[model samples]
Target: MPLYAPSPALRGRQLAADVGLLAWLVLWVVVARTVHGAVLALAGPGRAVEDLGASVAGSMSSAAQAAADVPVVGDELAAPFEALGSAGGSVGGAGQAAQDAVGTLATVLAVVLVVLPVGWLLLRWLPWRLGWVRDAGVARRLATADPALLAARALATAPLTRLAALPPGTAEAWRAGDPTATRALAAVELARLGLPADTLGRDERRLGLR
Candidate 1:
């Protein structure tokens, strides 16, 4: 019985998700490491943190004094005045953190977008060129002055050509991962052609196959 399989779209989606997750994880690691390194550079070993407590306390006192000067205001106004400075500082810190996070994320995303297609292009071109070069080598090897030898070579190579010419299958064994079925089919074809069966044992050992 044939195995059940997911559609190409579903497989593509899964691949996309996996790639995205991997990208995100890599970005996070980079950001974290960068931040840690930056912090270490700024505050080396034996360095002390600058004290902000005195400045904050002074600002709170000033605010409280300003609130006290406001006419007709009760003691309740002092509480909000005291809290205002801390609240503003908290808001500023939160905003800065958000900005930093966004900047880091943008950089990561831009890098991914830029590098992805270049990587794909390299992958595409390298294999295509290699295949062309390989086939050229095969042609060179099959180059013979004798007409009978050429005809024999052609006949022997026909099965491999047929196998290469097979319409890419729709089955699970062909679409995403497993290639055993396609390979088996190719082997059957080679066997049918009665290709130098004694010289070759494995499917890969066949001439011009690798």
Candidate 2:
């Protein structure tokens, strides 16, 4: 299958468009990564809170141990410190939960940021590129297999202005199997596809028609 137009100008444009699309995808990926990092930065405070809670829990646990060594009030004194330690542990859990939530948000937002615009562009661009490849392949085969078919396609699909620009009686002559008119019409169709008009001439020579 033909991947690009035979014409130098059209081929160059296709190449440029492909390169641009690659660049666009790379740019968006970089942007998504940057945004993800920025969002993840918000977790710094959560980490600080977790550390503070852990520090408090450890200190309270140590104090409770020390308090248990007291005489009569030892058990009662240790109870309050144990309660404080439990509260600190709850704070640490809350901090961890906040960090998890932030991490999830960062991932989701980054995915959305990359998917929407990139997917939309692909939806619009892929069909046209694929269509060109299909049409060009068909045109290439038909150019050799049946120049008359290409002539007929030109008569049916070429703009009226272009049709009129052809020599007078060109369409009527093509229908009458006039070689000149058939070649002319075929050239028109080939030009529209950015194929060389000489493709028809080569086929004619191979068939001993020239």
Candidate 3:
């Protein structure tokens, strides 16, 4: 037997879901890279400078230890210790600097993880609610929809390219799906959008789309 395929509606919905996931993943990657770069830059003089300072301090301590073990240069090693002690004065400053850098990284990551999704949702939902503000830059013909119909449009979020030339009412009924009123409203809407009246069935037409 041949494998069964989903209907066009099911396939379209799945494709939409996949696109949303891909967009979110791309956003997260960009955010992560940005946060990492900021933390590194704010570390001031970068990781290389901090590592160099630590290496120099460690080498000086090792040299002093060697000198003291040899007995003859014990006083010379004491001099080296004083020099190291002076260098260590900036240790606290470096730590504070690193802490501040890390804090900024945390803040940025928090915004990307927490705030960005909320913002995307608002942008996604809000325009559909308020018709005047939605992005309608494209010259595509949109269904002249009331608020509920508009809400359904936003919820569906179909790609403009994939949308078939639907009778607006049938599309709205499919979206809203109130069995009591759906067929009736769909009939009127189909007539309004110039679709065939038979599309909603004879029983639906007899029952006024109240």
Candidate 4:
């Protein structure tokens, strides 16, 4: 059996849905970007640990330099103190590096935990939504439509090149339990563009639509 073609009102509703979804996405992207900035600021730049390392090394070196300036016993003490200063410096440097690493890790974590999931959702929805956008663009004429207009759309999407390529008019024939050529052609086109899958008998009672 031939498929149902939705009325123009239904088509309009779908077009609006596609457009609304796009607007929704624009809002979502703004939210995502704002959240990203917030996360980055909260995470910080890893400088505090680095500064602590530098401070510890500097203090130990200062003590060593003062102690090393004295006499024979001072010479031995000075060497040990110098070694201690070097160790402290190493510790400080390690702390700085560790903080740097932590900052890097936090950045990765934020992207994965926050942005990636949102990105994934956008990836999933956008393609389907874009398809609707394209379909709507092609079927825009359906907003102010007719049998001929719908038929024109059907031909645009499908492989059917000529009306002669399809079965004869179904609307005229449908009453006698057959379909008309005009509806048959339009239906095929609408089907290609993904329309009219659900139709009502005519509380839809309007003209120029299914």
Off by over 4 Å in 3: 1-25, 31-35, 38-44, 67-114, 122-210
Q: Comparing 1 and 2 by TM-score, which wins?
A: 2
* Residues 54-146 of candidate 2: C-alpha lDDT, one tens digit per residue: 988999999999999999999999999999998999889889999999999999998998898889888877887898888877877887778
Q: Candidates ranked by lDDT, best first?
A: 2, 4, 3, 1
lDDT of 4 at 144: 33
Which ranges of candidate 4 are over 4 A from the true structure? 1-55, 72-74, 137-210
Q: What is the TM-score of each candidate against the true structure?
A: 0.32, 0.87, 0.39, 0.50
Instruction: Put the candidates in TM-score order, highest first.
Output: 2, 4, 3, 1
Give a tens-digit lDDT track for model 1, residues 41-99. Answer: 43322122112433554577688887778778845667776786666555455555554
Stretch of 10 with least lDDT, candidate 2: 201-210
For model 3, residues 1-210, the per-residue Cα lDDT tens digits are: 111113355345445654675687668767767776666566665454566656667767776676778777787766776588457535634755676777677677856764677567657644543332222211012222232343244335644332344334555565565543344343333333233334443343334433
Which candidate wins on TM-score?
2
TM-score of 2: 0.87
lDDT score for residue 108 of model 2 = 95
User: Residue 67's C-alpha lDDT in candidate 3?
Assistant: 70
Error of 4 at 12 (Å): 8.7
